[model samples]
Target: MTEEAEEELAEAIQLAQGLEVRGVNLANEGKLNGAMEEFRTALKGLEKFKRRTKLIRARIHYFIGNLHTLQGDLPKGLQEWQKAVRLDASLTDARMNVIKSLSDQGKHAEALRHAQLANSQPSPRVEILVMEGDECKALRNFTCAKLAYARALQANPRSFTAHFQLAVAHRDLMEDVPALHHFERAAEIDPTSSSVVNALAVVRGDTCQWGDPDFSENSPTNLLSVFATRDIHDKASPIHPLLLAYHLDNATLLRVVVDSQAREAARDAAVSVGHAAIQQHTNRPDPHARPRKMFSYKNTFSAFW
Candidate 1:
């Protein structure tokens, strides 16, 4: 209550806050244990002045939760974030993490509940709306998903993700016109996005709009470049190999496939060189996950070859 006591409390809170900042720096530098210790020590100190330190304490817990996630302890991270939101109801980041994690774990109903709650708050985030859409989509509620994606686009007209997702939703419903429109918009917003480029091309193909200017100018170059290394980096595109049979001769296609396989193998080896031990421990083969092999069109191109 006295001036001296007030000054001491301020100094203590300042010190705790500094520790939180330091913890964040350490975490960014990949010193997870050191970051965790800093966060815990900061939180412990802040707990002493509970009434004045609630928000800062909540923030510390949020950082700690992030550290837990980086350390591959997702459930523990979720618990920490839950604590953070409880401590400070307006901590939207923590709430968003909780909702996203729940959604990823296929607890769509719970994630939707949290998302709705967050949406009801003032100035809800575009990401929350997108996540709500994703959850609804996962639950097979196409109407709800469309509405959420539309709302996200309404909030941020230039949002590439929202436009792309909305396009996919419309495309799935066999609505080609609107799908083409959104896909084109998405490609315009992020021209380098391979998914948008491929989808845009497919949608145009569906509508038989071969003369579309955007496709003629950029999409084909980007799409075809996926077969070859662009800037010495393998560009990722999931377009089917069969489609390329219509475009190239057998020898060219085989050469492309061979080069692609070799480049992919080299990249894998380079990436694993420093992380072999870590991969050995953590990369146990998933029973349900298969090693995807390159598709061969040997029969389709055999006569030409």
Candidate 2:
């Protein structure tokens, strides 16, 4: 090929690599469909040049394999990974994918061997360590899983997933205290994670830290708090809010206010504070709006009529 054609091929391959990186990111974030679109786009770009497409093509295949794995097509995913390795044998990422797929297929020995080989690579990544832990967990090796998760944690303490997986490992091993501790930390980092919340609740139940058997009905005291911060489940419920409010209060929550005389005061204080927070959230002045309202519509109609 001419020098100009080679340069164009290099540029196209570079564009494909960027697209594949974006696809990998999207896949990591659990956007499989969108990630697949990006992968296909990258593949198309890589297919444009007849020369020097092996590296970029291998990378694209690796990403597509991840998409398949996420979509639960393990056989297809492993096939894609094999294709990736065949195209470019030096791609450690493809090797990692192969190890993960082998582990998922219950081929523990082969997976472990691949992991050992990958560890000998010049540089190691936390993802490889996490996959090692995943392999252990799949083999019902909680101890090994915990160790791997701890290593990942040491690498990056801010990883909510490592904390969560470590908590699960502890839970599986019947290590309640450590399990609860890790679960709580995970919850604090990702408060919106239902899995963490549910796991924390279950652990608390086992440890006698939680007592409520059901939350289908909101308690009298919690009614105020629940209204102040109810979730989608509460919205879907058929129960009448007022009727739901008649349930006995949480004794644990009520204990926050020491004196009986101050109990009601505390409840009122909490309600007022919560209400103000909600009001402030709702009443944030619109950035794109008139500076001020000249007249209030409701009061103006009432006064004029």
Candidate 3:
């Protein structure tokens, strides 16, 4: 309004921006303490300008809270975030940060409450639902986790993460059949994700459905079974190479079985047997290749002569 007030406002805004830049630079350099100091300095400048701009004041508090959060000072971060929210309830970043900080502190109930509040303001993002599901899972509340994951899947049916997490929730609850199905679905959606493939393989093994006729007929059941068995024996067994070999063998066997359609189903079964033999020879050490045992006698025939 007044020229002098305008000049003071401009100076305060410039100082806040400068402090923010310095804080970001310090944070990038891993100087969390220095960054926090700069953020505090920015907050002080913005507070001085708050009489003219409440929005800028809220932003400064939010950024300060973010800096504290990055430094693992949850209480201080939450306090500042709460202040930011008090100033402007529409500060979604502040609300989300507070929820994350609460969740990190193992306050899942409170975190869920805040998450619900945030969602009430607007439709929550898929990532928020995922976070909520993870927290519920960590708290051993599988039902709530499933619900959250289900909501995420409903929001986007093609979300591989949602399917994978839902599978994990089901597995935790010992719902192996559903877990196996969802795990396989996730692997199908994200074939390049080794974690997904490995998880699906684990669920399949746990369910002992590798021998299931439906999947065993055409799936990589045999190869996955061998891998699972080897892993059970030696936890350090390399799986990726074995899995690759298994896939190749499976492809070759599939072609053989298909081409042998004119023959009986027994012929298809024989193809599987041959594929197993090839896999064993290729992936396992040869038993006959070991040194032969030498036989010894206590008395010789020459002694009798």
Q: Which model scores highest in TM-score?
A: 1
lDDT of residue 63 for candidate 2: 72
TM-scores for all candidates: the values are 0.71, 0.49, 0.59
Arranged by TM-score with the best first, the candidates are 1, 3, 2
1-305 per-residue lDDT for model 1 (tens digits): 78997887898788998998888888878898998999899888766678888898888888888888888998998898889888887888888888877876889999888877777788778877877787787788878888998989889999888887788778767898998798778867776665654565456556755442222445643444343324324456443222222233333433453354355564442222223222334322112212222211110100100
lDDT at position 108, candidate 1: 93
Winner on TM-score between 1 and 3 is 1
Q: Which stretches in model 3 have alpha-carbon errors above 4 Å?
A: 1-11, 30-34, 48-55, 69-74, 85-97, 192-194, 206-305
Which window of ten consecutive residues has the lowest lDDT sum in model 2?
296-305
Count backbone overlaps in model 1.
Answer: 0
Q: What is each predicted model's overall lDDT from 0 to 1? A: 0.66, 0.60, 0.62
Candidate 3, residues 223-271: lDDT per residue as tens digits?
3443343323233222222222234445443343233322433443334
* Residue clash pairs of candidate 2: none
lDDT by residue (4-45, candidate 2, tens digit) is: 988988788778778877887887777889989988888887
Which candidate comes out best when scored by lDDT? 1
